[model samples]
Target: MSANHLEQLREAVVKMNVDEAEAIAKEAMSDGIAAMIMLKEAMIPAMEAVGELFGEGEYFLPEMLGAVDAYNKCFALLEPDLKQGEFEPKGTVMLGTVESDIHDIGKKILAALLQGNGFEVIDLGTNVPSETFVKKAEEHSPQVIGLSALLSTTMSEMKKVVELFEESGIRDRFRIIVGGAPVTQQFADSIGADGYGDEAQTGVELVSRFVAAP
Candidate 1:
């Protein structure tokens, strides 16, 4: 419950100390600090800071992956408590890495942050085909669908997914967003995607806006 504990937890996450982060989360839970508080105050902010550093080129993929791992460790400890608490999810989000793109660090980070921000996330993992996205969207009816592609070669798969959704007459049923290392806002626009996230934090914000829209 003490502010110092929160600060330590935050530092542990930012420093990519996975074991220490999980230990601190457990300690906070034992002290009745609440899962949501640790999430909103320490863990989320730590990842946001990591995102900022990544944007500034002070951090690289390995650093970001480490931070995500640390965050995941802490989140795993708190997730059950978060689910049991009095919380209503803001919306449902379905995420996956587009076909041929086996990379999923960005998608994983986005999924964790979405869950922390009170969105129910269905992460479909890497190498997801266009038809699979449409199939899952139909099955889940999520508010937002996020496509990720780390390689420029796989970026076209995102457009294919969007086109298939449109062809299925369900494109308008959900907000479609795209992102990854090689994805740009212009690319998203050209693919008819509703939005583009340059990073994990931006992805969460974009999804938030889509779900909050009238």
Candidate 2:
């Protein structure tokens, strides 16, 4: 497919026009486009644009939320129609906001970005306990586990969660990614996390690089 069609899909997603988004998605599929290609080339760019706009103050939370909703709706329509062997995920990611942190907007944005980029995300939602994160990781066996904590106080919870995984003997099984307002690369290093991102887009990029590495 030409880059123009991909750009059109991105624009539709930015506009939060569900009908237009669905039409473009169906068209892409009908044109024999690869699902992963569509996700990586079109949908992810669209959501990333929305995030950029939000960061630049050209868009607000409501618009960002709407765009994410539209993108997810389009994805739902296209997912079941994808050929069984044609959809190869970049990786599997389990994501959640750590215990005592009720702030979820950042976590939700990260989830959307990850899913839009072809990672199969298992979102565990807000205020997730450290034990629960370890338990879920054991059950799902994802390639990466993402923890978010917007509050400084809750950041310690990420360390405890890492400890839980270590105690479970599965610490080496998954790459540990930590993020949110209070999280820093130094903090991540101190806690023995594999990666740290200060923002949602950075998190997405970090995960992509981690999964793509040899």
Clashing pairs in 2: none
Candidate 1 lDDT: 0.87
Give each model's clash number.
0, 0
The ten-residue window of minimal lDDT in model 1 covers 78-87
* TM-scores for every candidate against the unseen true structure: 0.67, 0.64
Candidate 2 off by > 4 Å: 80-83, 86-127, 137-157, 166-185, 195-214
Q: What are the per-residue Cα lDDT tens digits for candidate 1 across 63-135?
A: 9889988988887787677556225989999999998888765587678778777889999999999999999
lDDT of each: 0.87, 0.83
Q: Which ten residues in a row have the lowest lDDT in candidate 2?
A: 78-87
- Residues 90-151 of candidate 2 have per-residue lDDT tens digits of 88889999998887756766776677677888999999999899889889988889999978
